[model samples]
Target: MRTALRPHHLRWTGERDLAHAIYGTVVGTAAMATAGAHRTLGGTVATVLVTVAVYWVAERYADALAAAVRGPDRRARIGRALRQGWPTIEAACAPPVVLVAFVLVTGDLRAGVVVALAVSTVMLSALGHAAAKHAGATRLVAVGCATGSAVLGVVVILLKTFLH
Candidate 1:
């Protein structure tokens, strides 16, 4: 019997998907954070979901098309594309949960948006650190990776503050 692979044993596809997820997270967080003042918490969350879904679909379609050109089994290529693109959609899951929870508890949509952005920033930082460590990066390099991911989220939040 084969033992299950450990989380640390990441394949190239896992790394690629992680990168996609990080990109998606940044996009989704930015979309909601920079939304207009008239936007409600639910509307912002829905917008994020729809934006990520559209991105996910577009990525999968492109990937599938590329695979179709290289292979004979269209169904398998489509399935592979869908699986590969799933992490991007999954990346959008966490921030909205934080948003909804904070909004429900504090009854403040703006505060919820702040909390959600913060939570997603932290998550991205963690993911960057893990990815770097998994690739045998030095501790300093891992920290730098984490900081870079965090800065992406922070920049978006800063833009929201200034723009809205």
Candidate 2:
């Protein structure tokens, strides 16, 4: 694996990770919009699960890229993978947690919870990306995730308002 993992290869992997994150964000938003249209607790749960799955996949990609860059030292590779993946995991969890809290607090199984979760995902993604950048990860990848998440959030809101 180390023999195949050159610096350029790592760079390309990072770029791909960014692209995947962007694509995942867009798809997740669309899924959430559809879920919001149903206005049911089950739909909300499904949307959250879908979004979380997308985020989990993106994080896995990021971890793989980090591992590729970290080389053959297993301990170092594991550490780098964790460092790269943790922020994304946290960011992804924030939105669902907020949604659940809001649902429990307000007892309203409506589109508002989905909207709030989408917005929270964007905000948390931005903060997570910033932290990842500060920790020496690829800035472009972080920015891409953050920007994509924000755009998706806006699109979700628009779809919920106009289409749903």
Candidate 3:
């Protein structure tokens, strides 16, 4: 049972970080693009990738810092922290992919932002539902939690609209 639980534990941490990075990147990109912060799709993609890398480094350092508080007797693996936070990079790819595809196919940056936001919202809901299931939530509770998580995505959309 203990061995079985370890993988689940690892996933929980990685998923949380991934979800956070996804939502942040989606919202940030949408807001910037809508506000005309980036003049080109290439520039927007660069900003998104840089944002993800910055967040990953911040989280990795945070994990190591927290572990350090527990002292040298329980050594922290800085490499493990890097590995655990790697999902952040994966999650950030969705927005750029959407942005590039829409820009190329439709030549509409606004549409790209909108579609990317929707994609990120869906991913957030899925992440939340999975998290609830991992916690053994009841069916209804899991759905409620998922909707709740999705609200964060909605907030991003609202901000983008207003910023635009």
The number of the candidate with the highest TM-score is 1
Regions of candidate 2 where Cα sits further than 4 Å from its true position: 1-31, 58-71, 114-152
lDDT of 1 by residue, 51-102 (tens): 8888888888898888888857878877787778565766777899888889
List of clashing residue pairs for candidate 3: none
lDDT of 3 by residue, 1-164 (tens): 56335643254454465465555545455444454467677777777777667766787789877766674643546555555655566666776788789889999987877888788777767767777776788999989978976777787788777776
Q: What overall lDDT, based on C-alpha atoms, would model 3 receive against the true structure?
A: 0.68
Score every model by TM-score: 0.87, 0.50, 0.77
**Candidate 2, clashing residue pairs?**
none
Error of 1 at 125 (Å): 0.4
TM-score of candidate 2 relative to the true fold: 0.50
lDDT of 2: 0.57
lDDT of 1 at 151: 94
Per-prediction tally of clashes: 0, 0, 0
